[model samples]
Target: MEKVRVLIVDDSILVQQILTQMLDADPLIEVVGVAGDPYEARELIKKLHPDVLTLDVEMPKMNGISFLKNLMRLHPMPVVMISTLTERGADITLQALELGAIDFVTKPKVDLSNTLDKYEFEICRKVKQAARVKRESLAEQYQRFAHNQTQKPAVESFPTTKVMPKLSADAVIKKIAVPSKFPKTQQKVIAIGASTGGTEAIKEILMRLPENTPPIVISQHIPAAFSEPFAKRMDTITPMKVIHAQARQKLETGHVYIAPGNRHLIVEREGTQYFATLNDGPEVNRHKPSVDVMFRSVAQACGPNAVGILLTGMGADGAQGLLEMQQVGAHTIAQDKLSSVVWGMPGEAVNLGAADQIIALDKIPRTLLEVLTLLN
Candidate 1:
């Protein structure tokens, strides 16, 4: 098999060197070239024609964001962000994702050499996943983001308007099936788990939901400083009230509780009332706010009243927990392989016989809504 060719683009020669060594260590990855800045990166991109590009956030001549926007508009492909762990870096990384990045690997917070090896496995894995991303899917996302970035917004809504995809729910849903289990005495709560490509996937599903939709709890693998902004971003576009998970907030219809960064979001029920909590314990599957943690928690807390939906991602973090949810009579669904940027998580769930339905990304909302309507 041909190795996944990569180009490292960073202002720091040191980071570029370190990344080159680390990425080259993997037999499946080949660092074809390295560029000091976007200008050089552009030239190298045209020449090398690499499968993946690793980009830094801060650059000398043009910032990574500006270059990213331009690149998406001109020539789109899979790009992975290599970012610092600072607050500002976190925000920029999220912006890159919205701008059409496939995934990111956070730089060492401190003791660079010591911690660099810690992410060696992760960096290589992400690059491999990125190389597999369907170019058409990324191209479409870039077209959407680039189109919105340049257009002028209406005066009144300009302050808060976001560029959401124009795709309709009917375009993706093959068939909507109601849960076989009828409504129990308790209300049903939806639990969603995603990583990698999930940020946009979640946005698409939630934005399609009605204001009267069922309550939702999400475990989206995100960095420490990006979760709140993600929730705020979703809130601005979707009618559903999106909030970072609070210690004791009760789950309510039409509201979404997103797991805060660096913590796991879990649901616990006392009688009919379901509440969300943050778990600061050890990371499961190398992710805080792990889908496995949240899914397992939901299985114990909501049981038959829970509905699990696993979306696009690159790891098996949520697969086992989803199986547990299915075993307990909770309806479980996984995003179909074709629509996913990286289908690892959902594919694993389907492989484990965890999903009652395997649906397309756009169809998730309609299928979910159909499930809710079937219940009490």
Candidate 2:
């Protein structure tokens, strides 16, 4: 098999050397070239045509975000951001992902030795995953990129009133029905699993829920340092209490538990009560905090009392587990393609007959509420 070619773009020679050493240790990856800044990266891109690029957020000639915008417009490719672990870095990294970078790794604030020791394995894995992403053409990406860039400035300058799209009652009613075999009891727990476009999607659903919503357990694909802040941001806006799942924390109504990034969160029944179990299990579906792990556990522990929601993501990570839930009499819902950023996960569940109701994004929360009411 051919090796995955990579280009390292960082101003620091020490970082370039360390990244080259770490990535070269992996037999499947090949370090094709290195660049000190975006100008150098442009030259390397023309010459080497690497499968992946490891980029630094801050560089002398041009900042990473500006470079990223141009790169996506002119020559879109899989780029993994190397960012510092600061609030500003987190905000920029999130923006980078939204702008089309495959993923990001938090740079160590301390010495090289400490950073490498902590992040070597993670960095290597992200490089491999980044290599697999399919990028859009310069023209196609640029059209959207330019539109987004101009839209914000235009909106701020003109201050035109924009209408919010509302979901019709008929559209909402179509997705509110419970499955024929849905258990006639309160669905006290909801287990949600999503990857890729989950951040914004989950926020939309959570913000729409009432303050008295049932307990929700989420397994969203995210890196280690990002989950805590993501949960905190959600908690501030939503009435529900959102936090990263901790081992042995009891599952309570109105509380939302997000699986700690890189750790699996499973549900266990202790007689009449349910609690979370955080474990360092082997990666399932190429993800540590995999949806499959959480959904399967919910199927076994909660059985008919659970509701499984599979959301927008890029892979079939939650398909099998959704099936298990359906087989065990749990009502399952998958996000419809029209509203999904990537329809892979939910599409797979629908194909496998796991989803009882396939709903549009805007209708999901309300549908969930109606289902819960009927079941109750």
Candidate 3:
């Protein structure tokens, strides 16, 4: 197979060189060209027709955000934003994603060598994934919507306030056919993994858990700076104690520990207590805080005492690990397709028979509650 072609666009020569080296180190990726600014990148794009572009947030001639807007309007393609690891950078990167950039990576200012080594795995993985992404041009999206409208059969208008009947607690509870069977007599831990549309999905699930819910270890694929604020925000709204995982922190019931964006969080058991283990190991499934690594650890440490949840994400990052959980007799649940923003991860798990229960997004919390109750 042909390697995924990539073009690097950055104002800093050092950044361009570092990123190019990191990407080229991967056998599945090839750096086609490097540009000092958008003007240079425009010329390279025309000449090389690379499959993916890695863009720096700040450039001398034209900023990445403005270039991204024009790119989406005129020639839509997969683009990943590389920004400094700062508050300002995080805001800009989020905006870039809304403007159609596939994803963002944070560049550390100090200790460049160590930081680059820490994030190189995810950066390369994002580039490869971005290459396979099917970008929708503004024109194409408009035309597709128009076609759908034309194809729909005419119907009488219905009342806007005719809300669909909500599922009752019993009805929702009955849908969780699979038993958790977790040994709640002993300490229990919940390990969750998600990516892609995970941000909103995680919030929904975490917010719904009771104040006494078991401690949760979550691995969501996201940038470093973003995870801190994301966890804090979840704490404000949720009944459970939600915060980013810190090294050596003791696992406490009713607290939700989100894995730091660029590091993996593993569970280490000591007698009757458990603690967080943060490491900079090689990326599993091309993610540092990989769901696979976390799940596998939970499988070993907690076994039947754990509840594993694989939420909406792209790719098969957590499938095998979730299967491991099932093999160990741990309860494993995956989010169903209709409620997922992108059904890649959970779909793969369901297809592979790794998931014990597949539940809709809204129903997941209730199902989890039922499972916890049964386990107790």
Candidate 4:
């Protein structure tokens, strides 16, 4: 197999050097070129023909969002954003993803020398994941998005490799035996887990749902700086009140709770009501707000009265937990491959027979609504 060719685009010489060193260290990736600005990047893109681009959110001459917009419109390709751990950076990075960037990695806020190994592992893994995306599918998705359609594209199957061994959901919560019978319940809760293409996908689902939907809880793999901003953005667009999950926050209907970055969001039942509980446990499946932890908690708390959906993402983080939900008699759904940006998570769940139904992206909202009606 050919190595994934990458182009590093950043104004800072230090960032350029760091990115180059990290990507080149991966035996499956090669740093083909480096550019200081969009202009230099354009020239290098034509000359080097890199498979993926590591773009900086803020650049010297022209900003990364503008360049990304133009690039996706004219020359569609896979792009991974390098962003700072600031609110402004998070907003801009979200915009880049809206414009067609595959994923993003945050710049280190602490000493780079001390965090180089972890940072390198993240960036390199993202770059390789971006490289695996099909260009034609990206172009199709971009055109539809340009026309305000909800249809997303599919990614070609690629090996989901891990740079370092990762901990499973068991690190945070132990698995318990699933009960053969579950008591009927009138109240229902919705649990969602996503990564990579999730921000846009989540927005699509939320924007289509009515304001009277059940209480929704989400665990999207994101950084600490971006979660609140993301929830704010969703609240503005969706009919539901979207809030960043607070410790021991009460879960209410017509509201969506998003897990804070670096904290596991779990569901617990008190009397007849549910609440969002936050955990500061170590990373599970190499993610702080692990979907596995969230799903497992939902399985335990809601049992037959929960709906679990795993959307597009680049790893098998939530597969087992989704299965656990199924075993507990919860209705579970996985995004179909045709509309997924990356099929790793959902596909894995399907393989495990965890999904009660496999649905397309555009149809998920209606399907969920129908299922909720049947449950009631």
Which candidate should be chosen as best, given lDDT against the real structure? 4
Off by over 4 Å in 2: 1-5, 21-32, 42-50, 73-75, 84-91, 110-125, 137-188, 196-213, 221-223, 236-241, 246-255, 268-290, 311-320, 334-376
Candidate 2 on 157-244: residue-level lDDT in tens?
1112321132221221121223345334353789998886677678768877866787899999887777777788778757779988
TM-score of each: 0.86, 0.66, 0.61, 0.91
Q: Model 2: how far is 246 from its true place, Å?
A: 4.8
Residue 92 shift from truth in candidate 2, angstroms = 3.8
Ranking by TM-score: 4, 1, 2, 3
Ranking by lDDT: 4, 1, 2, 3
TM-score of 3: 0.61
Tens digit of lDDT per residue, candidate 3, span 222-289?
Answer: 87888887787678757788978888888998899999988888887776688888877666676777
| 1 versus 4: better lDDT goes to | 4
Off by over 4 Å in 1: 109-114, 146-186
Q: Highest TM-score: which candidate?
A: 4
Off by over 4 Å in 3: 1-82, 91-102, 107-186
- Each prediction's total of clashing residue pairs, residues at least 3 apart in sequence or on different chains, is 0, 0, 0, 0
The CA lDDT of each predicted structure is 0.83, 0.79, 0.77, 0.88
Residue-level lDDT of model 4, residues 1-376, one tens digit each, is 8999999999988778878888898899999999999999999999999999999999988999999988998899999999889999999998888778999998876676566557888888888889888887678667756766454333112123321359888888887765565555566899999998999889878877877788999999999899999999889877789999998888888899999998999998876688999999989888979999999999988898899999999999899999999888889999999888899999999999999999998788878877777777
Query: Which tens-of-lDDT digit does each residue in 26-144 have in candidate 1?
Result: 99999999999999999998999999999999999999999998887788889999998877888788889988899998987677767778888889989998998877888888876
* Selected candidate, larger lDDT, 3 vs 4: 4
How high is the lDDT of residue 190 in model 3? 86
Ranking 1 against 2 by lDDT, winner: 1
